[model samples]
Each structure stands twice: as C-alpha cells, then as structure tokens.
Target: MISIKRFSELSYKEAVVLWNEGFKYYFSNMTMTVDAFIRKLANEGLSPEHSVVAYVDHVAVGFAINGFREMDGKKIAWNGGTGIKPEFRGQGIGKVLIEACLDVYREQGVDLALLEAVAQNERAIALYKKMGYEVFEELVFLQQNGAMTIDAFHTNSNFEIVRGIPEDIQLLEFFQPIKAWQVQVPGCKGAESIIVKKGNEVLAYAVYQRMMDEKHNIQTIALNQCEIKESIDVQKVADFILYHVFQPHHKIKRMVRNLSKNNRLVYNTLLAAGFETLVEQVHMSNRLDQPIKESIQ
Candidate 1:
C-alpha cells in the first residue's frame, strides 16, 4: 500500500534524498549537495507544507514540490520539482504526485498551474496531457564553454539605452505575459535592466540576473506599447553584456530568454552568440487564455 504525506512530516535528509533521486534520474551525473538543495528549496519557497512525499511500507518512493505566488492579480501555482525512485516506476506514483499538487493549487485559489518536462519525456508528457494540461510553449536550454566577446552593434536612428533600477518595478510589471514561471528569490540578487529609449520614450527593456557562475542570465525582456521597428539584434546585445559583465571563468552558463516556436530572430541571436541547445523542455499549463502582466523587464 502507498501513502501520501506532507513534506513537513519528513526530515530534511529525507527531502534531500528524494530531490537527489529525482535529479539523478534525469541527469546521471547530477550530485547536488544537501546544502545546495536546501538553499534552493528555501529560495523557491518549497517548504514541506507546500510539498508532498509518497511512501510505500514506510520508505519514501516519490515526492513533489509546489509553489504559489500572485501574478497579474491572479494566484498561480507551479510544480517546482518532482521525482520517483527508479525501483518504483510504472506504479502510478507520478500521477499521484501530480494530483496532489493540483489539489493544493485548487485549495489555494490558484486559477492556473504550470510545469516543464523534458521534451523527450514522453511518459510524463502523456500523463500531463491526460490530466487536462496543454502545451503552451517549448523552452530551449542552452549553454556554452569559455568566455566570448560581445560586439557593439549600430542601429538606425531610433532608440538610446537607459539604465534601470528597482524603482521601475511598476514598468517592469508589464512583462507578465511572456514569463514562464513567477517566484521571488531574495538571495538571488543583482538584477539590472536596460531600456531602449526613443528620445524621451521607453520602447523596450531587458532585465538580466547576475549569477555567481560569472554568467548573466536574461531573466526577461519585453517591448511595450510599440513594436520594435527592427529586430533588436539579440546576438550583439548578449555579446555586449557578457563582455561587460562576465570575467574569465572555468565555465559560463546562463538561462537565456524564453522563445516561442515562431520567434526566429531571438533564436538566431542566441545561436550566433555560441549558445547551443543542451535540452528542450515542453511547457505545460492548465490555464490557456489567462492574462499575465508582471514584468521581469
């Protein structure tokens, strides 16, 4: 027989074990220390109260972490992470974990829920589809080795660059539409924004998060009120950012902006900047036509 328990009921060691098991299943060489996992959970607000652990005969076999936040005035929930022990496969544990997460969302007044699964994870994808989840976007995870130089690109007479600050949170709030998931990471600091200003007008802006790995992650970028006259040329901007921000490091890896299937300009920009897709994940959501309006911009 199987039982589901709140994450709070388990000790920290048990939670870490479940987390490591799930990560290793997807990435064979993954070895996240307990400290790192704990930090991530705390950062993402994945406490035992919001998470679920499954056990069989008093042994933990699977677990799921969930998080919720307000976006665009609507409550949103995310399946932060989940995994089942290898020996417990084909026993419907994944389904149970997912259902438990959805139940939490429903009780929390979350109108929408979201998750990402590797594109090749057919079993998980099928299960999600069967549970009323639909594909909203496809995310490409890209990475690169060594340092690269960014070049300054000349654009036609239209926009100028302006530095942004946290005070511009209201303006940045405009980006809730294209963001994948929303959560606050207070310890994850050092965010900078650059606006493409047309004289006194602010057209588009990009927000980047500085990572400890000496790489800058493009958390979100958006153009508002007006469409970009010319493609903002992502390659030049990325190169410029890296050259100005990243120093010589053993390796540099950052998560780039999310791209829709039809967005070719940004795609080409990442590719031109030497970012090769390491993996592809399918973004599944329970809300199809919901409005999102928080800007990481």
Candidate 2:
C-alpha cells in the first residue's frame, strides 16, 4: 500500500498540505501558505521534478525537496528538506525517501549529496549515518530581535562597505569551500550582497535576504553568508557587516544561518553581540562514487 512518486505529479496544494502535516510538532513552526511554499521552492532551487513524494493507499504521506548545483566543477545535490507525516514516523518511511533521493543524485551524476539535521534529532542523524552520511561539520543558527546596540564600526578601521549583487560578492576570495551548501553562491542567488573594502582590497562580504509580509513590511532578515578575509580579525569584519545590514531596519528579526564550528570567531562574535543561539545542526554528506538504482518499498 506504499509507493513513491515524483513530487511534480502532485499539485502545489497537495504538496504544501503534506509538508505541513509531515512537519507537525517540528522544532520550529513550518506552516506555509501556497504562495510562501512557491516562493521557498524557487528561492531554494527545489524542483518538483527532482523531488519525491510518498503515498500510502494513494494519499500523500511524506515528501522530500531536492536540489542540484554544480560546485567546483562537480555536480552536487542537496536534500533541502525531508518530511514524513507525524503518523508515519518510525515506519521506515524516512529511509525509503532518503534512498530515493540518493538514487536521483546518482542518476543526475552528482558527486556529492548533502543535508543537515537538527542536532537534537538523534533518530534522523542515526538514520543518515546508516545511509552512508558522515558528519563533516557542525553548524549554528543565530538570531536577534528588538534593537541591536553592538558597535559594528571602528574608528581605527578604514574599510568601506560597498553594496553589490550576489554574483559580485561570490567572486571574493573570502567565499571559500568551507561554506555550507545552503550558504553557497547558488543559495545566495537573488539575495542582497555587501562587501567591505579598503580602497581596492576586499576585506569581507555578506549576503542576506529580506522577506516581507503582505503589508510589505519587513518581517525577517536572514543572513545566508559572511566571509572575512584571512589574517583579519573575523569578529571585527562581522561587526561591520552586521551594523550596516541591520541599522536600517530596527523592528525586523535578524538571523544568520549555518555558521560552521571551525569558523568560531564570527560565530562567537555574533553571540557576544546579543544574538542568541537558535539551534545547531550537523552537516552530513554522502559521496556518490557509483550509480544507485531506486528501490521503492
């Protein structure tokens, strides 16, 4: 009575309903309207044709959103999200969905498949391990609200911040291989970008996206990437970016995602500047050395 099919086969309403039901009682609220769901799919590069939906007796019971990007000349795939309806948990449905995703990655000639799971989600992490994923990095999410008072400016510093597009920001040397998949150039596409420069030399860069409510009021400011040049104090550069990024909007919620543990300066600085740790996640990856065939249960 169980089967899996391409997500493209379902209507947007069906997919969003399944998404909300699957994420019921999740760590964070994931409720989404049809319009929000469409925006997320387009922003995250998730495609219905590349994603999968699970069915039990012909009703949607679970779903996965997948995306593909070329990185460093290799095709990389990401499991943007995987969800199973609350009632379907512990039924081994997650395993089936993951296997389906890997099969799709292999078929697409992806050299790597990546995903992140909430650190507290032990069961999901264990399942990913069983599926050949290895924890390569630990990531942190930070957020702040109300008023940000930290001085993001330095009188001794001669850096000038320049606003640019994501493409221009990504070309900076600070954007390196260590970034998480969701913060990479592909993920930052269509986002606002800023770069700090001292004359012709680039010191750091940041990329963030703004989401507005129906009233056109800024609701959230999500920082996707922040890269500081080597040999410079990371915290200082981060402060500079934060000060300018949030100064114009005092009432909006500010957030930064996927700061790797290996990069502690920026991470620690954010916390010191009043941002609280929202959650931590483990970044896991599975390398596809050979083709894998889908075996739906």
Candidate 3:
C-alpha cells in the first residue's frame, strides 16, 4: 500500500535523507544537510504544510516541495522540487505526487500553478504536460567566470547608476510580471540591488546576492533580477548596471538563471558580454480550478 503525508510530519533528518536520496542523480547535485535543507525551505518560502512525502509499506520513498505567494493579487503556487527514489521509478508515484500537489493548491486557493523542467528532460516535461501544464516561456541560465575578460566599461550617461537596497525595487515603473519565482519581489527582500536613475526618474533596476567562501572571500555573485526601461537604449542600460555591479568583484564567478526569452534585450546583452548559456528550461504552468482538457482527462 502507498501513503502520502504532509512533509511536516517527517523528522528533519528523515526529510533530509529523502531529499538527498531522491535527487541523487538529478541534473545537478541536490544533496543537503538538515540545516541546509531547512534554511532553503525558509529562504524560499516553501511550505511544510503544502509539501508532501510519500511512503510505501512504512518506508519513505518520494517527496515534493511547494511554495505559495500572492502576486498582483493573484494566488500562485510553485512546485519547487518533486522527486522519487530510483527504486520507485517507473511506478505511478510521480503522478500521485503531482495529484497531491494539486490537492494542496486547491485547498490553499491557488489559482495558478507554476514549475520549470530542464528542457532536455523530456520524460518530466511529458509528464507535466499530461498533468495539464502548458509551456509559456523558455528560461535560460547564463554564467561567466569572473576571470574572463569583461569589457563592461563605465559609460558617460545622462542617468546615474546608484547602489540601492532591495526596498527600492518597487520604485521601478517597468518591472516584469511573469518572472521566475525565486527572482520575484519576495526574493528581492533578501538580496542587495542597484538601480539607474536620471535626476528624479528611475530608469532601470537590478538585484543580486553575493556568495562568500569560508574565509569571507567573494566566490559567486548570482544576479537575481535585472530589468531595463525599453524606451532607453537596452545595451547602454545593461552596460551601466552590469559594469557597476560586477566591476568591483571581477575575479569571482557570476551567474544569472531563469532569465526569460521574452527579455531579448537583456539576454542578448549578456551573450554579447561573453556570458555563455549554461542551461535552458521550459517554464510550464497550469490552472488549478479549471478542469483538465478532455484529451488528458
């Protein structure tokens, strides 16, 4: 027999083991200690009540992590992670896990459900599509080594690129709406940011978090959000923000992921600046309250 229970019911150590085991061979390493796992859950606003772990004959075998938030007054739920143990693969556990997630979404009044799958993970993508998700956008992860030649030069411009805090992100008039979950407003609250302004008019804004090694040496800087006013020169705005943000930390690794294809200006600018595409993903979404299409049903 199989059973699914709230992830909160599992001990921290138990959940940690399940997490590490479930994603042992995923596209990337997902192993985490109890502390790291708990910290990630807290930092990302993932819900213990909404998340689930599956059991077969009293043994933990699979899990799913979820997050919820209200954006522009619409309730959105994100499936942060869903994984099944190797031994449990080829069974129906994956579908059951998704159904459990939808149950939680409906219970929490989530109108839209969002998730991302590696573009090359056709099996997972097909499963998600069978579960009623439709592809809406393509997200790319761009990364570059700090030691690489960065030609982001300081430009003489009408606008002043000033360092700012996360609190100032809302002041930008042209923030993108359909951004990835982690780069959204709530995530910005925990990040450091910079913005461009001409006199009193805000033109563009960017936010990122710095990662430091044990010796407090700069290691990686992950750009969480970068937005530019379309009326202005895209390359110029990108150069201003990129140069100012990265000039001081030119020797560390810098990464920005989940950048949408819709933002061609910023995406192309990054490529022009020598950043390479590390990975690409398909952003898929579903409406919870609506009925699944007859074909899939």
**Per-residue lDDT for 203-231 in model 1, tens only?**
45455565442354432222111112233
- Tell me how many residue pairs clash in candidate 3: 0
Q: Please identify which of the two predictions, 1 or 2, would achieve the higher TM-score against the true structure.
A: 2
lDDT of each: 0.61, 0.80, 0.81
Off by over 4 Å in 1: 28-30, 147-159, 165-174, 182-188, 211-262, 288-297
Candidate 3 — which residues are off by over 4 angstroms? 148-150, 213-217, 289-297
lDDT of candidate 1 at residue 86, scale 0 to 100: 84
- Candidate 3, residues 13-81, lDDT tens digits: the string is 988889988997889888899899988888789998889888899998998899998866678899999
Best of the candidates, TM-score: 3
Number of the candidate with higher lDDT, 1 or 2: 2
Q: Candidate 2's error at 16, in angstroms?
A: 1.4
- Write the number of the candidate with greater TM-score, choosing between 1 and 3: 3
Q: What are the runs in model 2 whose C-alpha is more than 4 Å off?
A: 150-155, 210-220, 232-235, 248-252, 290-297
Clashes of each: 6, 0, 0
In candidate 3, which residue pairs get closer than 3 Å at backbone N, Cα or C atoms, i.e. clash? none
